[model samples]
Target: MSTEYKGPLSVETRKIAKDELREDDNSRAQALRQMRDWIEKNPKIISCRTDDSFLLRFLRFKKFSVPMAQEAMERYILLRQTVKIAFHNLDHTLPKMAHLIDNGYLFAVPGRDKLGRRWIIGRPGVFDPYKFINEDMCRVHGIVYETLMEDEENQVRGFVHYADGAGVSLPYLTLFTPKEAVRIVKNGERTLPMRHKEVHVINVPSSLKYVLDWGMTLISDKIKKRVKIYTTAEEAANNLDVSMLPKEYGGTIPMSEMIESFKKELVASRQQLMDNDNMEVRLELFSVQAKEGAVSALKSGNQSCNPYKTDVLTGSFRKLEVD
Candidate 1:
């Protein structure tokens, strides 16, 4: 029989594997090293598979030398349970969701604050903050929502299937706004909205423009002519949406132009890598990209790249709407 498992969380949202894994620094390289050392020293929490890598997936991250995994696991459980605490302020914050430009999702912005802040405090920064169409949901006792149902409350809840072929579902908690609906009408996929006054310009990655070019055709406005591409950050600012352009096209720092800059820097970094010859620098660059992405994901009211979910549940939960 399937039992209701009010057990513990399996992973820690905050406990990342390593800030940067280095070849030389064995401690940061693998969880195996930490587990083995701790088992050798004797750990009260562990009894079996004391030095196995498979078990690493079951626990949380810890200090490199010893298995602080138990400590880390406790923290993960605490965070998962307390996620609702941060949401408690949603009612007070997002009083209206119908007109919001960015859709009120939390986003991490780099260097915006003096002390530093992430989306949910102790987490990261989130732009376009909001609560819902008519209510707040900072506490667990708040009203739950139904997707595909445009209630007067406007609280839209749904699941999004994963892109990049990852088999995962992301649940959305929010109030639907008109701006988002418009973008959906325009682009087959959702986009982050870059608003300047009354005009809404969406910033899209160049790789994604082909899809958007056609997507915007059905948008409310009939004048679907060009997906105006900007060449520089300054120019992109004028359009309110920034995207990389081919160097030949002359807009948002071109990949070819970026490659030229890379050529200059690579010559220098190449020598440094050879001198120090650390393989981790290459990996570190990849890590930086992932770390930076966390910030963009949390922004509120973003048109594209915002939380435009596409997850489908086993069966959609719907409430009847009044015309």
Candidate 2:
């Protein structure tokens, strides 16, 4: 069976992974050494697979500050523990994950934004909240974890969650449980290793406004600031590069092809995802005080978390309607 759709669609998105680093940019090489040294010297505080690429992921997220990167890595693992989702036995081959893959509500777009952040689309088509299982959501989270592991070059600057609520029925909004909603918000907003550049909720039906507000209340003010509601696809595309987005968001590539390619990529990277299982924090090594320190490290706002201070786009979430 063919893995990718090979029509006249622009292959630009498919080729985004081949970004070249500048010759003068020795910062990463330097960061790699410092991070390794830090890990070796402080084995008690940090214990994970010492993969160079794995270490670099945290270093890049922390902007190469050795101490800060160490803290971020520890905090990430601890946060995974705190969330208590499918961190330990996250197998993509599970029945629930397979169901989610078949449904394809969420998947990362092949292309990156202008700033190099991955553009992930969440098109929860025909949402039946009664049918929206939490494990299905966890499957999405596992895919994201898989994505971060495979991003060795640190080319993924951040992420944009474009939630296409176009086809969601009103009942989904009302029926979604607060517990499930809180779990989704806490993990997706606070704990994920990458920066959340933006969240665009498009094509929101008028009847579900109250449900939307209740869901929004669960979203932290920091993340809620990034949430945007749009009446039309055109309005939503303004915040994203249309060419990078699939046809669902007024882009050129067929959504079916984009999703197929994503599935192929996921299958191709299965081994790397398994490798990541070793890299998760072994919480038993750290003392209670150490764990508290790691959690506090996450709250320090050292890396991409403080995008506004780091000179990223500065703006609060907005509600828009295009006539």
TM-score for each candidate, following the candidate numbering: 0.21, 0.68
Root mean square deviation (Cα) for candidate 1: 22.2
Candidate 2 overall lDDT versus native: 0.59
Predicted candidate 2 versus true structure: per-residue lDDT over 152-177, tens digit per residue: 43233567778777766644533333
Count of backbone clashes, every candidate in sequence: 42, 0
Among all candidates shown, the one with the greatest lDDT: 2
lDDT of 2 at 309: 30
TM-score (C-alpha) between model 1 and the true structure:
0.21
RMSD (Å) per prediction: 22.2, 10.1
Residue lDDT tens for model 1, 148-266: 01111111111111011111111221232323323224322211111111212323345444434544543434233323444333454454322322222233443434434423432
lDDT for model 1: 0.27
